[model samples]
Target: MARIDTNVKSIRYPVPCDEKLTLLARKLKRTKRQLFIEMVDYFYRSKKDPADMNDEMLKSDLSRIGNRLVGFFRTQESELLVPIHGMAQELVGNTETVKDELKSIHEKQGDAEKLLRENTKHASEQIRLLTSIFDGLAKMEEMRAGFRRIMEGYIAEREALGWSTSSGKKDELVRRFRLKVDRL
Candidate 1:
């Protein structure tokens, strides 16, 4: 039972037996104010209330616990302390080892991530180069086809004007077309 309220109302009372209270307070090494507080707490605690069964049971249980209580620290060199201390030290060592392993793993992961990024960049560059090369080859093929069509048109017009479509004339036409393409 504790009262911790700061906003206490002032109380003043005259006790009928002042000499006895003063003597008792002196013998108990308490101030008159403290004696008053103790008297109030005792009076309320000893007051019988049929509704408060929990307090009676708590008192009975608390008395039993007090009677059975033992103190291990009352003796020197306890048997439990050495094993507990050894276990704690072993756990500390294991924790340090785990920390070291975790640090190594973290470093390796960083290196692996860096390597992956570099590989990705290199792969992307290679893909870009390959794509450009393919595009140039495709454009060259298309230009060759266009040139062939233009040469056919020229040969057809020459044939309509009575020029021979013999192998000799075909060789001449091919040579001229190649010369023109090389110049361009």
Candidate 2:
């Protein structure tokens, strides 16, 4: 024979409450009325402001957090030491020095990179300036060559016309031809 749950009374709700009642009753491993009694008791206790209770709750929470942190560090310490256990003690002793040296090397490498960039910028500017100078020289050479060609052509034409190449006549011809060629 099954036991009967007697002495039940009706409970009312503004909204659907059957699901919540079933869940709470199942979780507490009790009848619906027992769960209701506990709920009512908690509701009256919670009528006090929670802000005051939170301070105490926060302290407990922090104490639990600290315990967890200590446990975490203990586990991590064992894990970290496992890999290094086989290494020679000499290397372990020098580990801090090696770390310092590596840090210094990294700092020097950064400085060297900055210096290299500065030097490269200076080199690029110098190359540009040199290129400009070379271009100017090339233009001047082209102009000089053009003037020589004009003089040579005038001499050839004058000689073909059976003209004299006397010193005084040569000077006068050069002066007149050069002035005419310069404008063009």
Candidate 3:
């Protein structure tokens, strides 16, 4: 085995450690004296030389550190209401614009479905009319699927933040939103 060098002499403590220190020493698998020596050495070494640190490097380090900290916090078992609140704040701000666009989509979907139904019922004798009706139906289905996707995304985001739709209020809101979209 290689020999380790010790430049400093060990000092003895006259009294026993307090409960916290004793527990810490046991947890760390080291005597209190050894821990103290290591800490003293670390402090002396840190004070001996100052590393060349710059703002850009410090910022990059902080960004990485912040990312790790956020990731760890996100893994913890906790209520997501706070995070959902932030998301709701963001989405709520854009609600008016989204609602306007949804209204236009709803109107277009309604028109397509109505045209398909009318053409299918009254123009069966014309092949071109039949084809157009089928095409309109397909388009309406696509639009409905798109609307469903949008709702799914909203619900998924909310769920990820720990919001459940089991409540009567949330269920009613979901039903109303879907009804409004389907009415188009």
Candidate 4:
């Protein structure tokens, strides 16, 4: 049992003066008034009553209280410099390394993207040339069919007119007609 301080005037009652308060004071190494103020602060931070709290809500409240208790113990036991300084330096180094690696990857990706765009443009130009060649071939076939029809018609008309089939006149007539068609 520890002696209560006499100079403390702000001590609130219903302050558990039992085994719990005694254990808490020994654990915190704080006076009863200081522990009370800590408890009040914790309560203020944790109080949030749901409109319809159930057993799950009660469990959540208990978990928060347990967390506050552990935090208080950790604060009491914490060192001022060693863990904080060491962890901060380690985190800073890790972040810089990660940033550098990401920048390197981004540069590589940008180069790959540029290459892909150039390849795509080359493929599109090749496709356009192929399409134009096919269109020209189709037009040439149409012209060949039209020329064959005209030659067959002229041969039929000469046979019907009783012209000499073996004469060079037929060749001359075909040449003159072809030149006229070309001009048209």
Tell me, by lDDT, which candidate is best. 2
By lDDT rank, best first, the candidates go: 2, 1, 4, 3
Q: What is the C-alpha lDDT of each candidate?
A: 0.79, 0.80, 0.75, 0.79
Q: lDDT (0-100) at residue 71 of candidate 4?
A: 91
Global lDDT for candidate 2? 0.80
Which residue pairs does candidate 4 place in steric collision?
none
Looking at model 3, residue 134 earns an lDDT score of 100
Model 1: per-residue Cα lDDT over 1-184, one tens digit each:
8989974777655676677778999999999779988878875787745467677866987887776564444232366777788899999999999999999999999999999999999999999999999999999898888788767876775676465567776777768767766753
Cα-based lDDT at residue 152, candidate 4: 83
lDDT by residue (tens digit), candidate 3, 61-146: 78999999988787652457677788889898799789999999999999999999998867765877789899999999988897
TM-score of each: 0.51, 0.40, 0.24, 0.47
Worst 10 residues of 2 by lDDT: 46-55
Candidate 2 root-mean-square deviation in Å: 15.2
lDDT of model 3 at position 152: 84
Which model is ahead, 1 or 3, in terms of lDDT? 1
Residue runs of model 2 more than 4 Å from their true location after superposition: 1-95, 164-176, 180-184
